[model samples]
Target: ALLGDAAHPMRPYLAQGAGMAIEDAQALAQCLSVGNAMVPEQLQAYAQARWARNARVQARAIRNGRIFHAQGAVALGRNLSMRLMGERLMDVPWLYAGGSEVHGFNGNAL
Candidate 1:
């Protein structure tokens, strides 16, 4: 099965490529660890668990790339928003935290 950049190539906007690769490895390991599960079942489980998360990250990365490369009024508005709520915009607790237990993975709480 494809994993890492081969599975989900994304722009560097969010700087999450390596992190996602690591996560993919961990998830694959966990899925494979299930003793009675067939190879196809494990692969399916891994894909089902990771596809949505990877897709979301890929979409966010594309959006962030657009924002970063924006010009004119769009750039102005983005800058204004950043100035007004930079900290809130920068903080991604849901992306950096949550959802580990759902997959039976012990990821960092950060």
Candidate 2:
């Protein structure tokens, strides 16, 4: 399966491209380890498992770019929110922590 830039090329705003690539490799390895499925079936399963999560990450990266490039009042508000929330605002538990249910995969490796 495609990993890193081959799978989803995203902006560096979220700093997750490399991390996602690593996760993709791990997930793909796990999918391949199943051993019962054909190559095409395994790949389809990998795509199904990763599509949503990758899409979300890509979208977040784009959104973060916009937020980071914000000007005037928007920038002011963004800075204020960051200050108010501190590390909590930047901490994405769902993205970092596992437990997401992806089709064709039963592990929390992602």
- Lowest-lDDT window of 10 residues in candidate 2? 99-108
TM-score of each: 0.87, 0.85
Question: Model 1, 1-110: lDDT tens per residue?
Answer: 88899999989998889888888887888778777668897788788778888888899999999999999999999999999998798676767973343242343211
lDDT of each: 0.79, 0.79
What are the per-residue Cα lDDT tens digits for candidate 2 across 4-84?
899799899999898888778766776776766688877877777788888898999899999999999999999999999
RMSD of each: 4.3, 3.0
List candidate 1 segments past 4 Å from native.
98-110
